[model samples]
Target chain A: MPMMLDRRSVLCGGLSALSLAALNAPALAQATRLRMIWWGSQERADRTNKAIAAFKTAKPDITIAGEFAGWSDYWPRLATQVAGRNAPDIIQMDYRYIFEYARRGALAPLDDYLGKGLTIDDFGKPNIESGRIDGKLFGINLGVNSSVVLYDKAAWEKTGVTPPSMGQTWEEFAENTIAFGKKKPKPGYFATADASGLEPSFENYLRQNNKALFSADGQLGYEPADVAAWFKMWQDIRKSGGCVPADVQALDQQNIESNALTTGKAATAFAHSNQFVGYQALNKSKLSLTAYPRVGKSSPSGHYLKPSMLMSVSATSTNPKGAVDFINFLVAKPEGVDLLGVERGVPASTAMRDQLTTKLDDVSKAMVEYIAAITPEVGPLPINPPQGAGELAFVLTRVSQEVAFGRITPEEGGERMVTEAKRTLARK
Target chain B: MALHSEILSKEGRASALRSRGTFRRILERNAAGYIFLLPWLLGFFGLTLGPALASLYLSFTNYDLLQSPDWVGAANYVRILSDDPKFGAAMRVTFTYVVLSVPLKLAFALAVAMAFNRGIKGLTLYRAIFYLPSLLGSSVAIAVLWRQLFASDGLVNMALWQIFGFEGPSWISNPDYALYTLVLLSVWQFGSPMIIFLAGLRQIPTDMYEAAEMDGAGKARQFFKITLPLLTPVIFFNAVIQTIEAFKAFTPAFIISEGTGGPINSTLFYTLYLYQEAFGFFRMGYASALAWILVIIISLFTAFSFLGARYWVHYDE
Candidate 1:
């Protein structure tokens, strides 16, 4: 009887011990949640998710939440968030917006983090410098980009027109466009698409003319005649039936997929060479890249290498170390390069670029080769324009519209631009 | 003798106190009613009245939202009126859009309402079908869809090629045709007016129609003499509201033109230009001036509408 009673007590104690262990299991485990924000398409999202899973495997204690949007909505939303003083720890930034946000004290400088094992030597110095503002590193460039003219190979063959070779003059370009238009003179179909408004395209022109949009002193750069000539060229293109009309250019900017070149209505379009990856998904026709047209003096300084976007850490971030680690991975890690592909531009790291090429499809390989072939006299990327720069963009649009509507001559429009630009610069 | 005098004085005081108590009760009841209205009164004071006054004050200053405002009295207004050419162009475009679109939309609404009022079968189905456009009309998705439909190689051009053997112009992209396309889009979503007209039609007395029928009046004649007069109040209401909405239109311009009001600024509406200044240009003071101008213009137009309504709008005695 005594033996049986002792056995029953042991069994009861064992069951109670098991229950206690079960109750304490959750207390031993940790919970950590992190949020990340970016702007990109479904493919980019998928690759990012894969990288997030890999990150989770390395650090099982951490959890990541992601938010994303298209390019248009992303910056405005991010700006509002920053103004509200509640931004995400890590943000995917565009090159245009890097300086603006950094100057506003929204982004954290990465010098300290670099001292603590976060250098991007794997990425080249020129690529890394693209994200600096006032000598402080504010962003990490994932790749490089330059303007290239993308032409439809099939359409060029049909029209019996040769694509513009590297260093082609504006005269040859106009002649080819007119010839292509004559071959296929259908409504809504033209030889060439609209030129880019300001940004890289305008800067390209200024550099070719041995001028800049802003002087070394950061004031209005060019004479009014330069703008007048640019407007005259567009007007001539529209009048000669070598390009889509003003109205069509308006629609092209609205829905990029509906642009004349994308719909096979035009022979060529202007875009970053890196954009070929994005276009490959949208167009069924094969696209090939050529250098931007030569103008004025046509020196190597006319063209430039630019970072398409940068990844930056937020000033308000609680996980500055983790953020820097992620940026370093984006720039230095082979796996991160594989995930990003050429979406950010050509890989900044030589080894990463070499490794990525064997696995990359036709478009990325071509972009790498195109960028490599250029002479190294590329000018330093321009700083983000001042506060009233947005007004200048709108004013340019208005001036162009007035010229197109015949409300004003191109010369008058040029004068209007100069006046507005001065006013905008004064506000700055 | 002293006891009698004291009792008489006490009785007189009590009667006077009763009258005072009754007066106090009336005051308390009045206070209760005001207490019931306090929430809405507070909302008006806090949200609407405060912002309206602030916007008015802001119009006289150079405010960029990021820094303290500086007083620059009348400069913003003067620049908009005289120096800014785009401002004048935007005004002209907005006026043209409002004048053309409002009347066409109303006529379409009235016609559609009349057809539905004929005791047709599947009335609910038809109403739902007509109402779908109004529900989705102002959405960015609809504007994007419109861009595709009216694009250079869109369905409209495709059908034109098959039927007419001639290509159509890019309707939404063309500066000459873009405003007309917007007018057409506004006309397409006439469901709200049609619904209001339907209700007004129901309120019309059947006896009047019966009397007209007995007098050998035709359907069109009865519509003019009886239905038209009865529906005037509803039509007037819809017109004022729609005119206000037309003057403030922004989404279509933003989405269809990608914020350039493009194709040579043919689609540049007034509100869009204001947005460009406020957010794009960081000219808060200038935008505030523009807002006040819009408010004044809308008020004048509304006043004109009410003044004209005396000639046309009819009310039952």
Candidate 2:
């Protein structure tokens, strides 16, 4: 009797298992799940989620799991994920890191999927080529951005000082800043945040002098004397009270919210054009954008329309086709483009740009206009920075601070900076 | 009778078989206990020992996380000791923090513990309230709060301006004062050591104090001569543990400086530097070397502490 019952139960179990598999087959076959990760603010995360929801509604068969982190935490997390061979299907990459990741084979080359699944034919040659490393496409340009001087128009007007113009020299800008500082709009407020430590601002200064932060061969493009001269200019400005004090400048944690301009310690800040909206939101006064100061009257603008960030598929992704389709949706499709807006910077595609122009808010409109105003003066994009370029940037900030605090002279700071930069680049 | 005799014969045969092999006898004796210890054994080997051994191997190689490691011998260690300036900066910062913060924290903890031992009203409530900071001190939120409090326009500065008409610099952002603010933070979270001190205070007999008082000893005399000597072991314990913790401090400095270990690397703790190398710069091999160096330093400190304790730590022998 026991044997008979056992056999009966086994048969029943087999039949139930068959039915369960039959029920799950359609769901399993249709769901091509993908994971995408990016780093940005809460506002960016919300916009990204809305775009993801829209994509889900359009493609009911594919599901995407989105993850986001702040910029400081993003790279470490991504590096760990890639090292563990469990990288997300889609990654939001930075210009400084794209070369490293692509060269190391952590990212998939998107050239094969270009016409078939990834439609970026309208993204212009330079914009598309910005993502290439060693002649192979590795990332897709999500938007275009350039560094700018963002200042409070009201603050400058109150001081009766002329605001910085589009093509002003660094000397003229420094004079105006000192003039504003003399007015003393607030007890502790300075005209500008100290930009000596800022990497982008330094890079722009280098380019105006016809030197770059790095050569095409991944070596220092400028000498220690160039760095010392740059540091001396800022030091003179700092001495004349044209910029915030060293301690006050240190409070800015390289974010829009913590910036000296936003915190009311200074009237102006050095930032990328994409950050104008965030800075405006944080400040009580109206903020405006102008080009970074040039070296002289006939110097290059030292600005280029580079990708603010890019979307790439990981090399180890199981569903590269699906990831490409989603990326195409983000960069090319109207619905995705409309939702993202200019948060990541101006959209790369002309069609998407035209569509969003009518709907953009005033702050985003200012960013677009600023980019347009400087388009004719902008220079060609420099090569992607070398692998240890990130550490070199921090080295600059450290040495800059030492100079700012009067702990070391600009010449010593410059020498130290070069030694450290060379040592960092020489490692592996 | 026949069944009992058969059972006895079986037991005698099993004992004879067990006595034939020491390994089998040992396993047989503690099989159930070993089964119960399996989870902890697995964790120690898989989680702790395994990774520790791997890091040891990686320390001698040039591992950049993306590529496979190449053997580099003791080059990383040599660079750290001789060539790296940041390593020196980090060591100075960490040692200053440990030396300044540990004794201050322990003194604060002992003072509070003694106050509680006097059987004050709401002793438990005060203990809980004071202990709260330790629970939250190492957390990221508290570190961020510390940043806000020490900011140029933050509450502390606001209070100073309102009361003293003084404009203070940003404490956490100035190289001259950044490490000291961290020391203050370390001193503020003295709750765990306070609780341990309280337990030790309770263990001391009241008769000694009573006898001292009967002998016309004043309160200060009683404290120095009786209470302190008796509490030496507890003080010694707290000192060693707190010193080790201070040496390993990372979060407050990381959050306060926003991970640059600036202004001018004044707040660069050794572990923070290690993290920057491993995660920020992806120099895993060099970071592993840093980790091993830290282990050696900490071990040496601990060994010296134990050896030195014989002179100060009084026991009831």
Candidate 3:
């Protein structure tokens, strides 16, 4: 019996050793395998994969693995990966999150790699500076974009109502939209999506009003009265049937495919300028983009050239050099830039932007043109949103819906929003 | 006889030499079974119990995923109970769901189960068909499909318009109807409990029904007096399980609402809210506190159910 036990123990030990060996074999064979993750639609993924293939062709010795998820799933997935210390080598970052991730020490500082591997001479000083947090460069600006009203030009033409122009006041825009709705071009169609809940739209409105979403110290920059006024404006528009019904607008989910314009429920949608390409692809009508309406005729432009998204190397990455090299190629290399059009917004590099302008399709060209058009009018970028700002975005959406559904008065909704927003910001 | 005495004396000497001989002998006899259970045992410790204990510790701290945990000592629990409006909303939603979905799902399951127990032909085929929804109901794909089906211009609203000249508000988007749509989805997936009820129905002797018939009892009378009373134990079992599942329902609400639990937080299930807190807001400590509260609530409910079983659940005794 002792002899049998010895034999069994030896067998088990050998099998375990062999299995462990099998797992390690692949790592040994691969010279430098890097993992990159991003969140986007299939279009962005396709362009990114193409660029990756291009990179692999350039650097055959360094193999790369790519992963992607939709917008909502991406952050949570990345957070869990970071928490487990198993983050990908390369990460596609968002403007709202870069500050948080960088401050938390999840991202490697790119200042050391700037000119060595990451050549951004043509990327422009301010464009590169946009990724700086706490005086340290944490992310590479992938593209630049701002809030815009995307509409179906053909649909608006059919309604015989002049569509919103770039410099129109909010009141004028509302009146024009209401006029379109009064035309009754379609039985169920409204003039625009309800943008009262959208964080960007709200932030843009704040900018026009000389207030911002968050003060520099990360508190509510605007008062509850401002929020009440914002909600009241939307309520007026909604009452006039100038925007899609609250229930119909609720289905948008802030995605291109679910957009009121794309779904034919509304003629226009409030979204980022970069989404123009994706929206046009989905809608039968030819979609067009314009800057969000101003608060008044002489109001400062709420539009700012925000880094649509950024690419950062994870602090836990084994090969930070390899990650930085890929980001440079993606941003600066002509062939790499050509592979990825303006789907991630217009290229941050002037050289890449110039090269791709002629090569891009009509829809992509429009996005580039729109950004260029808004450049002079755009204000300075607002401070990075506070840690709890993301949660507050949802709060705004909920309170907006409450107001829209007549469950709460605009004033009550405003008070609730301010209180909840303060509570969220104060949680930590 | 002399050899047997020598063997007994040797065994006694071995037992005297090893004080733990009885325990070692028991282990040695079951060594193969224990080896076979090693994988499950490792998983139970490493994956389940380890994380559970970690969460329990985390519940007492202020641990964002990116930062090291700070000892806060019941601050998270206090905040959840006292200050969090979303917590209250989530509780209301979950309790409403459990109270409505559990009994309704059970009753639907029992009805379908009793209908099938009438000894119909192709019973296996019918059972399989009815059971398909339960297999697929909790999945993201099914939830997405549910979203489309309940959209304002979806197939349901189209049918409503065609049949009754009525326009239905978006069932998946309207606050008033969104949770009910989820509840309806829950009711539709009654296949598993129905299968259990079918088996329990099979356990009851047909002679009881025959005796009831001889006593001039009608079908309704017999079902109420015999079938229902006999099925109480199974119903209790199903009730406990379904209530737990309803409390933990997250995927459908998450998917249908695009993970916002929206149309004014109408579909904010307790678990969904916990996930949002943990992941969306990066409030891991608070989420852990929420999870502990859920565990306590579920345990209390289950305990009360067992205590209440004495009054309702019947047994042969």
Query: At residue B38, what lDDT does model 3 achieve?
Result: 99
Least well predicted 10-residue stretch by lDDT in candidate 2 chain A: A1-10
Best of the candidates, lDDT:
2
> Residues B179-198, candidate 2, lDDT per residue (tens digit)?
99999999999999999999
lDDT of 1 by residue, B1-317 (tens): 56545544774455456766756544453455568889988899898899788878889998764445789999999988887777887998899999999999999999998899989999999998998898898889988888888876778889999999988878898888888888878888898998998989989989999999999999999989999999999999999999999999988888888777777678889998898776655576898999999999999999999999999999888
Tens-place lDDT per residue, model 1, A1-428, is 55555888999999999999998777645635556789877877887887777777766766667788876667656765764567888898877666667776778999777647476776666776777778898988767888777888777778888766687877778778778778874555777885634445666777777777777566778878888887787777767878877666666662346556776667788777777787777888788887777673356446778887788888888778777776666667787778878876887778888888899877778878888876365677665455455456656766776676567888987898888889777853
**Which has the higher TM-score value, candidate number 1 or candidate number 3?**
3
Chain A alone, model 3, TM-score? 0.93
List lDDT for all candidates, in order: 0.77, 0.91, 0.91
- Model 2 residue pairs with clashes: none
TM-score of 2: 0.94
Q: Order of all candidates by DockQ, from best down to worst?
A: 3, 2, 1
> Which scores higher on lDDT, 1 or 2?
2
TM-score of chain B of each: 0.86, 0.93, 0.94
For candidate 2, give the lDDT.
0.91
Q: Report RMSD for candidate 1.
A: 9.3
Model 2, residue A85: distance off in Å is 0.9
